[model samples]
Target: MVLDAYASSNPDQVHEDVLQKSRDACYKARDAFYSCLEKESGKKPTEIASVGLLYPKECSLSRTEFVKSCRSSWGPETRGGILEKPYTFSSSSSKFVLLISDVSGGDLFMLEFMHMMTKLRPFVHSFLKEASKMFVLYIYTMGDRPYSRQMAKLLDPKGEYFGERIISRDDGTVRHQKSLDVVLGQEKAVLILDDTENAWPSHKDNLIVIERYHFFASSCKQFDHRFQSLSLLKSDESEPDGALATVLKVLKQTHSLFFEDGGEDLSGRDVRSLLKQVRKEILKGCKVVFSRVFPTKSQAEDHPLWRVAEGLGATCATEVDESVTHVVAVDVGTEKVRWAIREKKFVVHRGWIDAASYLWKKQPEENFGLEQLKKQGTDEKSDDVNI
Candidate 1:
């Protein structure tokens, strides 16, 4: 409210100063208001920030115009309407492609359909800065119009990244699923980053599946997860070496390949195929075989590890052959492990494949060796005995 007032008072400079200047002004206003309330109610200022409802009497008198204007502008009827439209950068010559998602970029937690708290994924701002350079960035989220606009304000306050290309739940097609049919660009050029794969079932080829970011307890609870939230743990995903970082590198490569390598014909290029090819090269030139990795009754090709290995561009086989490069096993005593050792092939735990899948890079074989697995098993057994 204070920041809004400051923006209204300095309409000419608000665009450039809202982030820093208005932030400072809001903090000062909050402090003064809370101090005044605390003196009247005999409560701590810290508690006032959280759940205090007392309005500062001085602010009511001093900021009467601002409050009156705000009330008139944001009355019950006007509040639900669209705040802003999608913006287009006239200087950008690149082919405009839309990015649609619900969870990949950020997650919003709602309390009783009234208050909302948003937690942006790590490196999101950096990702947007980089992505905006390559594609005409558009945000299509399932959140409501007001909430989406609020998130956009935090993400691209200067309005340089995502002009008016924001689409909210109110703009969605029937069944509440995101559809590229409404997007102005060609379907082949659009690339979507979303955590829920099924949400874009029709556009799976264009969709890049990302791991969901769960920061708050409410977010985890919404997904029916019982694990501790990142907020409660006081830790977040690594900013430098995190999911968004990896995704940005992929986007850069895709954009470069799309514009530079794909020749002058921009319409013929598709980022989805480029992304698939890039992912395939992560574990290329390797043959992986699993021993005792899956249950005896389970189909070798149907196993999760097999799918992960194949997805990473590694050929998965049931038997250790001369072409095999790595033997993934749980126990070092397995016959395939001995065979791999005899053939001088890399014998590693299943975690090596899993790590490569998650990191999108070939993990060091030394870090996932049978010795490490043996030590882990020993430690587990010792702990069990102690129990």
Candidate 2:
């Protein structure tokens, strides 16, 4: 249904008719296989314990051949090969950074897999162009071999960025976890960018978590989320100052720090530690207090805002003191708000902390003050009453 809708909207971009026919053929083949299993097991289709147990050898072969033929007719196969060597760089350059990045939900989101309609995440091409100058870029994805290669082609059409360094699920371990063992060269020198942290549990020190990109309805559905997609909204993240742009700056800083000391030994240097230090400095030297932000009777220490403030290097206190630099409040009539006004401290809304967390930078207080929030609340309430 999603594909149909996308195809209708983008008639020239997708081969919806061909995909629909192919889907019908697959359905018919599946139904035939199920019927054969039902007959062999001497039971109804729903009563069969395992379809593989009753599947006949001849029927299995026939079904496999049919599917293979369908795939061949649908699209060309993706090419695969071993990467021989890294791309040539200037001889004067001092360092070569190793980067392993994911594809789906990281660089782009698949809207129609059959027709191959994808929405690229914001700043993807710009980020790649900037990072490629400092790093030997590689593509790592949990998707199948053909799909990964196809996406790599789309992302690097000129073949200048990721040259044959594409690793898919077929090349990874049987346990479905990515390991540095498969990656050649020094493990400590390599940095990984991926949206899903659990995919690389063993290499957390080398992994930098990225915000997941959801640009299609099916992509969000796969993760059990129902938010509006970028395609549906007809908007994308800010290209000039988006998450990818911010991450590129961090990557550049990490690369610079790795080669800063002019030392021969680069084994001890880790980008993860640098990333932590950069994050810790975002809200450093600031003391914060919250009012009417947590549920009544709930521990303030256990609240998410408290943990976020601490994580961003802010000191959280229940009571306002002389050192209080900011007061996070949702209500304008709170005592803390009045105290912050009297003390001339920054009195901001709950979104001030959230925006900093998402943008990885401190947002201006004037943009998220109590007056703006009150006006927003009034407008929403008026709309609700009218509805």
Q: On a 0 to 100 scale, what is the lDDT of residue 143 in model 2? A: 73
TM-score for each predicted model, relative to the true structure? 0.63, 0.62
The parts of candidate 2 lying over 4 Å away from their true place are 1-93, 96-100, 103-116, 174-179, 185-187, 217-229, 291-308, 329-338, 370-387
Backbone clash count for every predicted candidate, in the order shown: 6, 0
lDDT of each: 0.65, 0.65
lDDT of 2 by residue, 303-378 (tens): 8779878877889998899999999887766788888999899988887887776567788989988888776562
Please give the TM-score that candidate 2 achieves against the real structure: 0.62
lDDT of candidate 1 over 331-382, digit per residue (tens):
6666888888899999888778866765678999999997886765531111
Off by over 4 Å in 1: 1-92, 98-100, 103-116, 174-176, 217-229, 261-263, 293-298, 302-305, 330-334, 337-351, 366-387
Query: Can you give the lDDT of residue 335 in candidate 2?
Result: 84
Best model number under TM-score: 1
